[model samples]
Target: MPLVAPTTIQKVSGESQVEVPDLLAVEEPLEIRLGFGPTSNRQQKSVSVTMRTPGNDEELAMGFLFTEGIIHQPADIVSCRHCVQDAQKEGNVLRVELHPDVIVDWSRLERNTFTSSSCGLCGKATIEAVRALTPGPLASEFAVDAAILHSLAERVREAQLAFAYTGGIHAAALFDANGKLVLVREDIGRHNALDKLIGAAFWQNWLPMGQFGVFLSGRIGMELVQKSWMAGVPLLAAVGAPSSLAVQMAQEAQMTLAGFVRNERFNLYSEPARVRLAQMV
Candidate 1:
């Protein structure tokens, strides 16, 4: 619901008739604020703000924190709430408070000076910067069959209600070990969709998804891979292509990455060993 935006469009007919319809789109903006820990004096000072669709904002904040390695466990987060008490003033701001003993690394916090829905790595200095910040690669103990990967793509597509109505939103979904869809979120920006999904999982105390898989309604990119890895999800499936960097990161992280998932077929990019093709046979 927060993804809707007001826009005017002209519809022209063959003769000369014109019509205008309000357009819906995922909202994007800067949400600058600071993160505080209840017990310690440390806090993320002068954090950059980014605008986003208004729905599931709590999840977005939590997911962002998790992906950025700000907090490892759900318990580390003491609380997350709107920065402003008044609804009218808190339009897009959220404040995340962590437990006092939780580690607050200033060096890592400086990297995220600016963020955008389209590009998650908006403020990084270099490719090396990404490599340096990469979380440990996922352990290769999880098993995900090719059939399950194929099935997940269909499930993600089926869950896309907003796209059905507006034909212009992306979706992100999480599935259990058995490939049953657990949660899903949609937004105009692919990154925001994933963030919302992550936020939802965080709120539900579903971190370190070692036994779960992530499915995306669009292409799998480096940012998507990074988010899944940060959440400890061992597998990622996308309906479209995988960027070259995404493939590289998945391989390095030991995550099972799949793309072009449709109609019972998909391309596996990394950790194919975990995908049992014969399971379908």
Candidate 2:
């Protein structure tokens, strides 16, 4: 939570001087470590590593595991602990231990290396590679009103404290069945904010958020859709537009996808039935 102070300087412009204040941004390195199988006896396997903001490290780690198809239920996570043994060597490396009998495909994980907060898949092959890893599409026919989708932008924006302060952070929020904001997180990177929110939900035993929806402050892309899909969230709303591939994936997954949510208006690219435009009037 450290920030550099803004500075003001004067420059000679002919016979005049000008001063301006510089904004200070906070950045920190967060390392995510996976411990699979049995937290009681402390038996675990290191899966993937990621660099992110220091806050919400545990949630980020748990959300990562769920999205990556490593574990299904929250009980599978034995414990997520921040390791300080090599504090000097590793800056804020979190070690997550999982329950026994947990199955992990190390071969698939090894194929991909470190993931950045911005882009979840750094060393993956192609879009098809991600598609292959995703679990089968969802089957439920969940629905929400278009008015709710449009209002999501304002609710999400109101909850973004970091963005309000620095005007330089992305937010990811979860809403309940009634379109009420339940949880929100902000970070310099969109994915990191999502991971932090997911990670926090995981620790709080809020996984399988089947009756809820996800809202993003940025554009809806494949990575965001994949993350929401893995979390068992059936609907995704964004303040911006979505990529073509994202729409395709949402259709395949049977998930409702909305973008360009602004001023009580939005575009439903897929699963229109899920959004009740008629209910608003």
Each candidate: what lDDT? 0.73, 0.72
lDDT of 2 by residue, 1-281 (tens): 34223546575789987786655346666666766554456554556555454567677777777777676778887778788689574546778777777877766555433232333343233344555666567665567766678788887888876666567778899887688898998777778888777877776777666788889899987778778777777888888898766776688777889898898778888877778757435
RMSD to truth, every model? 4.5, 4.8
Measured by TM-score, how close is model 2 to the native structure?
0.80
The best candidate by lDDT is 1
Residue 44, candidate 1: C-alpha displacement in angstroms: 7.0
**What's the true lDDT of residue 125 in model 1?**
33
Under the 3 Å rule for N, CA and C atoms, how many clashes does model 2 have?
Answer: 5
lDDT of 1 by residue, 13-123 (tens): 786866677757666663645566654356665554665656777777777777776766778776766666656655566667777877677676676432323333532
Q: Name the lDDT of candidate 2.
A: 0.72
Candidate 1: stretches off by over 4 Å: 5-8, 12-23, 28-32, 37-44, 85-89, 112-135, 279-281
Q: Please, what is the TM-score per model?
A: 0.80, 0.80
